[model samples]
Target: MLKAKVGGALPAANEAMMQRAEAAIGDLRQNFKAWLEEEVGKLEALMRTARTSGIEGEAGEALFTCAHDLRGLGSTYEFPIITRIAASLSKLIETPEQRAAAPVALVDAHVGAIRAAILQNVRNDTDPIGKALAEELETRVTKLVGERS
Candidate 1:
């Protein structure tokens, strides 16, 4: 019986298989971008509803869920800034207690920031505008939560 060497180069067949898999996934990034944009639109609509209805009960929960989903996907889709902004929004409305008291102005700030970030195509944390926006959101969240506490 022939034994394969450990920690050695991959077998030629295995290497070929890996290459084929990579090729198959070549369009994955493009598809992800399209899907991410669609999801962002849905999130925006949820934000609108939350804004009009006030972020409480079902509306608040929906907004939080959308923000959580976007937060999770942003980094994977090469939008680290989105991840940061979404994280802020998610944190702001994390609990039912928090959601009940969540200010519409604060929620609007967060949602508007997210929409601006996406519409302006801010992908990285290095962008000055993205950085500023993130900081502003963080400050607003801190101030509002502090006032409530």
Candidate 2:
């Protein structure tokens, strides 16, 4: 039986490709701050709309979507603390029933924290203040939402 070629020249080519990929990612990193800011701005707009319309309708759903997107994008944007806080916010309003009962102040706090992190350059949990804020928000959200799946 004939076996497939193992790891010869392919490994070298793969290594070169990996290096190129890393360089591309590094290039993209420069734009991450602006991208993250745009996302946060959208989230803030959604928050305002949610406040005006109440959390039981379309605006609330949009707010949840914005938070979910921020949760997924935060780490990619070099803001892992944002990911943590956004995750907690996502959990707190994941469902309509939860949104109906979710405190506007709590949602406002999460958004405010995200804005503060950006403004203060607190990108991750390594920062003491960022860590404390993320932990507190997560704790509060868990108490209300009973942990997210």
- Most accurate candidate by lDDT: 2
Candidate with best TM-score: 2
The regions of model 2 sitting more than 4 angstroms off are: 1-16
Question: Candidate 1 lDDT, tens digit per residue, 46-139?
Answer: 8888777877778889889989999998887778888898888888898888888777788788778877877888887798988998998888
Give one digit per residue, the lDDT tens place, for model 2 in 1-149.
12345534333357788899988888999899899999999999999888888888999999999999999999988899999999999999999999998999999999999999999999999999999999998888888879555
TM-score of every model? 0.77, 0.87
State candidate 1's TM-score: 0.77
lDDT of each: 0.81, 0.91
Clash count for each candidate, listed in order shown: 0, 0
**Candidate 1 lDDT score at position 34:** 81
Looking at model 2, report the run of 10 residues with the lowest lDDT sum.
1-10
Error of 1 at 30 (Å): 0.8
Alpha-carbon deviation at 90 in model 2, angstroms: 0.6
